[model samples]
Target: MRHRRIGRSGLLVSEISYGNRFAHRESANCARAALEAGITTFHTAAAWGHGAAEEALAEGLREARRDDIVLCTGVFWLEHPGASQFGLGRKHLMSSLHGSLRRLGTDHVDVFQLWRFDHRTPLEETFLALSDVVREGKVRYVGTAEWTAEQLLRADALANELRVPLLCNHAHYSMLWRAPESQVMPAAARAGIGHFASMPLAQGILTGKYRQQRIPPGSRADNDERGRSAVRPFLDASLLERVDLLRGIAEEAGLTMAQLAIAWALHHEGVASAVVGASRPAQVAENARASGVELGIDVLTQIDQLLGGFVQSDPRLTFTPTQYDDL
Candidate 1:
């Protein structure tokens, strides 16, 4: 696997990073496969299966040396009763980090990210708290997930002032979702913050499995309510039709639809890593192979011609507004 540095940071992550958002039953096995395939970066969150994902990762990497793995987790979305239990507040962040560390069986995660921007809280307060974690040696680098370009710029400035420089920004970027290219990608490039592309497969849409309105058995949409809701928007006939066209191009290039999608996401210079979710070990192996696969310019143009109009470039799609109000 090819390794890329996150901006100017010392951290070098695998081009294809393993993420455990769904937290499948074979999570440990899949993670092991990722490691065997040279994927050292593993991403999880406090809200992912309510810490079960971290536990599985800990078990999967139990035999590997701690320094060899780049474990990443997020705060701002823990299971708690009160409103104060979420967001980037000092109390909540401290508590959330402690819980994550305990679950992962590690003294420090390579990167600790805020799951979402806490609009209700001042940026100063958030950065101060994150800087404290870095100083205390609890987290090596600070980052954000689903934060907009503007929000990332503000946070990066604050983090610099606090001496903790925000090193990464996790956002949705896939063959079907090109939203980050418009603003987030440029902003991260200018700020020297590495962009980690989440949902590189568009939640399995680019995998060519959900075609002709047929949701395959045991698929994410069939098994998880939230997964179904998340992918429902892209189920229109027009989008699927475009995917069919892209599939033809993938076959012409001697690649699977999923491989084509992953290679496309990594083609951008601004994207340092593509965070992919997998339920099985085989899926992990397949995705890892796409890391260094460079598509020809003609093939890229064909992909864009087929999918340009279908791309979801809305900046607001980065994070849900209701999440803040619900908290």
Candidate 2:
């Protein structure tokens, strides 16, 4: 697998990383397959399966060398209702990291990310806590996910002030969602922070299995209420019809629709990695192969023309739980 450093930091990750958020009862199998496929980075969060995901990932990586893999996890939106259990406050961050380290059977994690921007907590406190974790040897590099472009720039500035290298912004960017391209990527580019495009597959919609427009049994569209809701907004008649057209482009490129989608996200210059969550081992391997596939300029442009009006590009139009009213 091809690997790249996160932003200006020395922490390297595979072009195709594995995340266990939606991995199933066979998560161990998927994780093992990732390691076998040379996937060094694995992502989990305190909110996934209430920590079952972390333990399952550790079980899968039990036989691999510790230093050979990068364990990247985040904290936010916990199951608990306590006031102190959900935000990026120092107390919650420390508690969450300690719990994650213990669950993963490690003393330190390679990258500790804030799953969301906690508007209630001061950014100053959040950055300070993140810096403290690096000093305490619990976290190597600090990052965030699903944050607005303005929040990311302010975060980069604070990290610079605190001298803590903010490694990357793990945002929702894909063939269907181009909001990050509007301002997030440019802001990160100016701040020297890398970008990890989460949800590159659009919750399996880009896999082309849905091209027939039939909801397959046991698939995410059938079983996942949240997943269904997540993709519901984007599955319009025009976009769905356009996906059928996209299949031809994928065929011409000698790639699957899923592969084409992932490669499309990676085609962006600032994207250090594209994080893919798979429910099965074969999905893991299939996504792993998308690492080195290159699309030519003509194919890329053709794809742009076909799916042009369907994508979400404006960051202002981007919806997230937290907004920068302070901006």
Candidate 3:
């Protein structure tokens, strides 16, 4: 697998990072397969499967050298009883990091990210807390996910003030969703912040597995309520027809539809890594092969033409408002 440095930081991550957003049950096996396939970066969030995903990954990485893997996790959301229990407060951030470390059986995560933009808290307070974690040697680098262009700029400025590097931004980017390309990508490029393409497959819609209206048995659409909701928005017949056209291109290129979709995401200059989640070991192997597959300009143009009008590039699609205004 190809590795790229995140932003201007000294750390380098695999171009195709393994994630455990929906692969809770088989996370261990999937992670192992990814490692075997040369995927050095693994991403998980504290809220993913209520922290079970991290535990599974820890178990999976038991046989590998700790220094060989780049582990990433996030804070700002927890499975607590009350609403105030979450956010970017110092208490919550520290507690979340400690909990994640214990579960992952690691002293420090390679990267710790803010799962969401906590508008309820001051940016200074949040950055200060993140800076403290880095100083304490609990986190190597800090990052954010689902943050808008403006939010990223503000955070980067604060990181400069605090002498902390806000190294990466994880945002939804895929063949179907190009929202980040317009604003976040340019902003991050100018700020020297690498972009991690989360949900690079549009929750498997771009994988060509769900061709018709019916949800496949034992698939994420059938098992995960949130996954179903996320995939529901792109379930139009016209979209499916376009997917069929893309499949032909994949075949001609000697690639699976999923690999073509992943290669498409990695084609962008600003994207450092494409974070992909898989439920099976074979799927991990398939995604690993797309790491260095650079599409020719002709094929890239054809993909854009086929996906015309189907690309969802609206910035508002990734906007997340503050949950608590009073805080």
Q: Per-residue CA lDDT of candidate 3, range 211-252, in tens?
A: 876678777888878779878988899998898899999999
- Assess candidate 1 and give its lDDT: 0.86
Per-residue lDDT tens digits of candidate 2, residues 189-263? 888889888989887778866654567676777887886777677567778888778889999998989999999
C-alpha lDDT of residue 88 in model 1: 81
In terms of TM-score, which candidate is stronger, 2 or 3? 3
* C-alpha RMSD values across all candidates: 1.5, 2.7, 1.8
TM-score, every prediction: 0.96, 0.94, 0.96
In model 2, the number of clashes is: 0
Q: Model 2 off-target regions past 4 Å?
A: 81-84, 323-327
Residue 190 in model 2: shift from native, Å?
0.9
Which candidate ranks first by lDDT, i.e. highest?
A: 3
In model 1, what are the clashing residue pairs, if there are any? none
Q: Which of candidates 1 and 2 is the stronger one according to lDDT? A: 1
The per-residue C-alpha lDDT of model 2 at residue 311 equals 77
lDDT of candidate 1 over 1-327, digit per residue (tens): 999999778889999999987566899998899999999999999777777888998888888889998999998775545444778888888888999999999899999988888877888988888888899999999888888889889888887789995789888889888877888888988889997889999989999898997888888898978879988988988889889888788888888888899889999998889999888899999999888889999999998788878877887677634455644
* Clashes by residue pair, model 2: none
